[model samples]
Target: MKKLTLVSLLALFMAGCAKNTTDSPTMVGADRDEHGCIPSAGYQWCANTNRCERPWELAEVEGFDNTPQLFEAFCTGQ
Candidate 1:
């Protein structure tokens, strides 16, 4: 029983060690390369204009509102 348990645990560990080559789901409506910035909400990255933009503003243009504000937001603090 102990050997079985050890083998099962080792198998699980080895399985976990296997590299996952499949691409994972990216951020909705935005990707790191597309935005040219890191993946973070709230003015972290902007793909439309290739600059930092607020997530809230991006949300505005998510569906039908493709206004300028939705493209980018220049805050003071950055």
Candidate 2:
């Protein structure tokens, strides 16, 4: 009886430790949705600012901007 109980407890502990990928929420930018950010043709997504920015641009609490810009130094056009 003791051995059986220990084995059951161990099994339960192992099961709890197992990862539940299906039940876990998917992170932002993982899917193609407005809530997520997608970089433009010449820009990259900045997770820190949650915006699409140029490689040289510094992220500063900015959000996603899909607008097109002309003569812009940064890839803000995206």
Candidate 3:
């Protein structure tokens, strides 16, 4: 009755809290992609370099166009 409802509500609240911590993209230092890149810190996966990188910085160093298409091609090594 009331006890069961209280337990259910508590469980639901805990689940919501857990989900926020695990799935949030805005979790600062805890937010990392599958490749361990942290977007908040401006690091993204670069398949060409096989590491985390800043696209604009990489483009400058590699002498490539800074467009999104070029970045994708370069990052994907296409």
Best by lDDT: 3
Candidate 3 yields a Cα-based lDDT of: 0.85
- The TM-score ranking, best first, is 3, 1, 2
| lDDT digits (tens) for residues 2-68 of candidate 2 | 9999999999999999977796446644443353444433455544445655543342323424333
Winner of 1 and 2 under TM-score:
1
lDDT for model 2? 0.51
Q: Where does model 2 exceed 4 Å of error?
A: 23-32, 35-78
Model 3, 1-78: lDDT tens per residue?
999999999999898878444454555677788999988888889988999988888889999987778888998878
lDDT score for residue 2 of model 3 = 100
Model number with the top TM-score: 3
| Candidate 3 local Cα displacement, residue 64, angstroms | 1.1
| lDDT tens digits, residue span 1-78, model 1 | 999999999999999999777687555735554545545444465545457755656556555354445444332223
State every prediction's TM-score relative to the real structure.
0.37, 0.33, 0.61
Question: Can you tell me which runs of candidate 3 are displaced by over 4 Å?
Answer: 1-27
lDDT of 1: 0.57
